[model samples]
Target chain A: MLDNSMKLEFPSKSQNESFARVVVASFAAQLDPTIEELADVKTAVSEAVTNSIIHGYENSLGIVYIECEIKNNKLEIIIEDKGKGIENVNEAMEPLYTSKPELERSGMGFTVMETFMDHLEVYSEEGRGTKIKMVKEFKSVSIKE
Target chain B: MQLHFNVKDENLIVRFTGELDHHTAQEIRNKIDNKYKNDMLKNIILDLKGINFMDSSGIGLIMGRYKTTRANDGSLVLINVNSRMEKILTMSGILKIVKVYRNEDEALHNI
Candidate 1:
């Protein structure tokens, strides 16, 4: 029963992204994922965390929470922000999509998450908050040579 | 990320250091695109010697630069890949399009 889950809290912002990724990667070690799988997880984490920092907080200060759990051979990550939630999650999930293109964001956050993970779910409401749930399957782990 | 820049026969040798996740991707893209706009760059040698991490965003960044260089009739070469990122690049089908060199000098000399 290695169904361990971690709760993470960070100040909502982009600068702390690297820090958050490292933290999440360390917690996700139980899956014994391949380097590629790890990177995929990290990227999905980045997309969600970036969304929390950029879209959720809108550059304002807030609290971001990430929860991870391993269940049924799948790694589940939940990134939530207590800030202005997305109005249209469907529109936000488009590839190469970005509400703020000037930021050099590919706007492919959800697309990236979907591409890397086995599945992704977004729950949001305007002016309330947003929660993103992602599940990635660990089939065969391959260590780096 | 760390960048090592050198000039060889007017080609730009930019070696990346550290992770190439979403955080550093824009900087890399902008810097290289700026070079494409300003410099008389004939070729590019991306030395991935120190890059321990990369993702699909990095993949997009690479492909975008590949198209830019190909349009300019210049070439883009990747060198000194680590084990993991190399596997990703291989599976992503980048190896078929972009030439991989064993080291920086080979990439520079090959182009």
Candidate 2:
């Protein structure tokens, strides 16, 4: 069995961001990261959640399932949504390329995900869904006495 | 997120602590722009070390400041970057225009 792993589900929205954060934090606890690292994880989670809401659901209603795993001292997060999947994952990952600029998205969600995490992989198809998987290794871990 | 301003050597440094989502970007842009008019600003540095989360709205803020700083014949620098934020900056290629430093001291000295 994996020493650190978790999964959660939530409706896509700003308020549900906390739910995603909590899940990531729980899985990241073993890494014993500094407060800054913890914040980084949460911010990455926020971006993934935002994408699930904005792009996956396309401003409609949908469920987001998040799964996190800690292996070899690295944290991996997966955000999945069954909505209008991205037709071109590459275009969506580009910076400032949101389909809904009127919503003021800045279209940087995937960029942030790619930035904060050590590794990122996106899977999606039009009219299907999108799954964002991210990994981050804690550069520093605290030791408890 | 709210902002904290630190002024030294006539350079204005803004530290953002909180989420820079779409809802807050416009107000932040206005506030920072207003500060420029309020004083004879020389250089500006943004200390994003405390920023936990940001979206495209955050990008807009940085781009706006880049423009504002250039118009005044000054420069803008961003410091205390984490990986996630670094990725965003890299993707946006803001590094091509704005300078990013590891710390405020470094940014201040170089600016």
Per-residue lDDT tens digits of candidate 2, residues A1-145? 2457777887776677766776787678778787667766877787778777777886698899988877766787888999999988899888778887655456777777777678999999888899888888887854444
Taking the candidates in order, what DockQ does each have?
0.22, 0.27
Candidate 1 structure quality by residue, lDDT tens digits, B1-111: 877677777788887878886668878888877875677787888888788777655666777778778998998888888776775566556678999889876776678
RMSD of each: 4.6, 5.0
Tell me, per candidate, how large a share of the native contacts it keeps.
0.14, 0.39
Per-candidate clash tally:
1, 4
Off by over 4 Å in 1: A140-145, B26-42, B56-111
* lDDT against the true structure, each candidate: 0.79, 0.78
The CAPRI class of candidate 1 is: incorrect
Interface RMSD of each: 3.7, 3.3
Chain A TM-score across all models, in listed order: 0.92, 0.90
Window of ten residues with lowest summed lDDT in model 2 chain A: A100-109
Q: Once model 1 is optimally superposed onto the true structure by TM-score, how far is the C-alpha of residue B67 displaced, in angstroms?
A: 7.9
TM-score of 2: 0.66
